[model samples]
Target: MTFSPDLTETLLRPLLRTDPHRPRLTWYGGEPAGRTELSTASLANWAAKTAGLLTDELGVAPGAGVRVLGLRSWQVLPAALGSWWAGLALDLSAAGAGFADAVFAAPDADPEVVAALVDESDPDTVLALSTHPLALPAGDLPPGARDYSIAVRAHADRFPGVPVEPTATVLQADGPLGGDAATVADVIERARALAAGWGAQPRVLAELGVTVRTTAELVAAAVAALAVDGSLVVVDPASGHAAGTVGADEQITVSHPF
Candidate 1:
C-alpha cells in the first residue's frame, strides 16, 4: 500500500488500467446537481495533440516548466498529462495565489507556453477556453488564455512521455500538516493502509478543499481507486462532502473522501 515517487507509473499505471482507458482520462465537474462527463480516451487524444503543439511547434523543452491554471477536472488531467507527455514540469498554482507563470495571464501567453487548458465553462466563467466567443452567459474569464479546443486541436493526436530531472518541480498537494506545513511520506503510507482496510483499489474518490485536507489523501486515494480499476468519482463543490460506500466486491471501496 506504500506509494513511491515512481508509483504513478510503475505500480499505479497497471492498477489504473481498469478499462482500456488507463492511458486516457475522464473528468466530472459541478456542485448540487451533477454536470456531464469527459472521457479518458478523448483526453488521451487531446493530450497527444497538445503535447505535439507545445513541443514541436512551440519548442518547449521536455524538462521545462509548464503550469496548470485551474482546479481538478477532466480537462486539467489532460493538460497535466500533455505536459508530462511533452517532458515538461507541472507547476500547479492555486488560482488566487499567484505564481510567476500564472501571472503571465491569457493575454500575455505566447508560444513559450505549451497552452492553457481552461475548463469548458459558461461564457463567463471560462469562456476563454470554450469554442464559442460570441454569446455570453454571466461571469468573468481570467483574460489571456484561449479556448482549450484551439490549443488542443493545434497539435498532433499523439505524444510520447517526457523525462524528468531531479531539480524540476511539478506542484502537487500533499496530505494534512502542521499550520502551513504538509504531511510527509510516512503519513501517506499509513492512509494507504487505512484505505486497504476499508478496501484496496477504491473505485470512487472525492476531495474537497474546504478545510485542512491532505494531498496524499486526495492523490493516493484516487490512485488506489484507479488501482482496482475503479472509477475515480470526483466530488463536486456544490455536492457538499457526502459520498456512498458499498460493501467490497467488484466496486471495492465505494467512495474515498478527503
Candidate 2:
C-alpha cells in the first residue's frame, strides 16, 4: 500500500516531523489525570504505537471498524488518530460495536456494559483504556479482552501506516441527535477551513463532551490550532477543574465552558 496524506497527514505526520516539540494539547485538573500536556512528538508517538497495536496485532486494516466507548479524554485523541492512521473507520455507538473489528472502552465505562459487550465479542478484540498518564494497567478485564496500556506499550514508538485512499470512510456517528459519516478527505477539508476561520489564534480551549466526537469538530478544532501553529486545550469535566479556572490559567481564547 502506498502512503497517502489524508487527515493524519494534514495534521499529525507533518507536525511530528517538522514541529515535533510544539505543544498540541494541555489538560489541567488534579491527581492521576491532572495537568497534562502533549507536544506534537509526544502525541505522534502515542498514535504510532496505537496504530502498531491495531494493525499489526489486531489485524485492523483499511475500512476496518473500531468502536470507542465512554467519555472524551486525552486517550481518545491519539487512539482516534491511530485508527485513522491504520485506515480504519471510527464508530462511537454501542449498536455498532458488534460489527466492529475492535472496541476501546475508557476505564470509567459501565462495567456491566463492557462485560456484556466483551462476552459477546469473542474473536473480535476489545481493549480497555485506563487513561492514566502513567499508562497504568486496569484491573479485571473481561475474558478475551486486553488492557490497552499493556498492549500499546509493547509496540514501537514509530508505526507508520500503509497507504490509504482519501475517500475511504474514516468516521461515522448516526445517532438520534443526527450525524453523518466523513471521509478522510472531507475531514481534512473541514480542518483547513476551520483553521482559516479561526484566524491566527495560538490556542483554543473547548469542552470535551459528546459533541466533540459526534460533530467531527474535535479533530477539526485540534487540527485548526495546529494549522496556525497553536495548541488545543481540552477542558475535561472529570478533572474537577472549573472551565473558568482553566480559561484563566491557560489564557484560553476560544471555548465553550461547562
Candidate 3:
C-alpha cells in the first residue's frame, strides 16, 4: 500500500519511515559540458539493498543518525535518499560551513550513500536531505555534519528505496548566488527554461520576489508561491533595496537564479 503522507508524524513516529536513493541533479561547473541523471527509482533500489548491510550485517541500532557532508556532486542525491528510507535521522551539512556542523549524533558521508541512508536511520526521526543545485539562496538545512564530494559513477546506479510520504521533506539547501534586481522578462525567460525540464505550467518555489519588470523575478516569485512551499514578501521598491535577506530557515528546495 502507498504510505499515506497525511499521517501526523506523531503516530508514524519515524519507526517506519524511509526514502528512495536515486534522484538526479545534473552537475554544472563553469559552463555546460555533460549531464547526469539520478532517478528516484534507482536510488530506492540501492537504499534498500544497503540497509541490509547495516541492519542484518553490522548491527546498527534501529534509530541511528548520520552526519552527511561532501562535494556538491550529483551523488549526494542518493546518499540522502538512501539514508531516509533506512529509517535514520540524516543530518545534512556543508563541508566548511562552520563548527556547528561538527556535533554529536551526526554521521558524515558523501552522496554515494543514498539508498543506505535509511538503514542507518531508525528509532530517531527519518530526516530527509537533498540539494536542488539551483542558483538561489539558502533554505532550511537539516542541522547535522560536514559535507564531501566523490567521483561520479562510483557505485551502482540501482537501489531499491521505500515509498515515503508525498509531503515529506525531500531535499534541502541550495549552493549560492547573488541578488541585483532582475526584470520580469528574466523571470519569464527562466520559467521558460525551467519548463523545458520540469514542465510547461511549472509553479515557482520561493519566498521573496522584489523587482517589477523581469519575468524571471516575477515568474520566480509566482512559481515558488504557487507550486512549492514558500512565502511572497512584497517589499517597497522605493527603498533602493539592499541585498535580499536570505535565511536558512526560509529558503525552499531550488536555488535562486543566476
Candidate 2, residues 173-258, lDDT tens digits: the string is: 55321246777666665555665545464678876662253323555566567656678887766667677788888887666311
Looking at model 3, report the run of 10 residues with the lowest lDDT sum. 98-107
The segments of candidate 1 whose C-alpha lies over 4 angstroms from its true place after superposition are: 1-18, 21-35, 38-40, 93-140, 165-200, 207-224, 227-229, 237-254
Q: Candidate 1 or 3, higher lDDT? A: 1
Candidate 3 lDDT tens digits, 204-240: 2222223322222332343233222222222222222
As for candidate 2, its clashing pairs are 2-163
lDDT of 1 by residue, 1-258 (tens): 332232223223344344444322223333223333334454456567767766776666655555544343334445545655665544443332222221112221232332333322222212123211221221333543445545456577655455444344433433421122222233234435544544543455454443213323444444444434444555445343343321122232454443
Residue 253, candidate 2: alpha-carbon lDDT = 69
**By descending lDDT, how would the candidates be arranged?**
2, 1, 3
Regions more than 4 Å wrong, model 2: 1-3, 29-33, 93-98, 110-113, 140-144, 174-178, 209-220
Q: All predictions: root-mean-square deviation over Cα?
A: 8.6, 3.5, 15.3
**Number of the top lDDT candidate:** 2
| Residue 129, candidate 2: alpha-carbon lDDT | 70
Lowest-lDDT window of 10 residues in candidate 2? 210-219
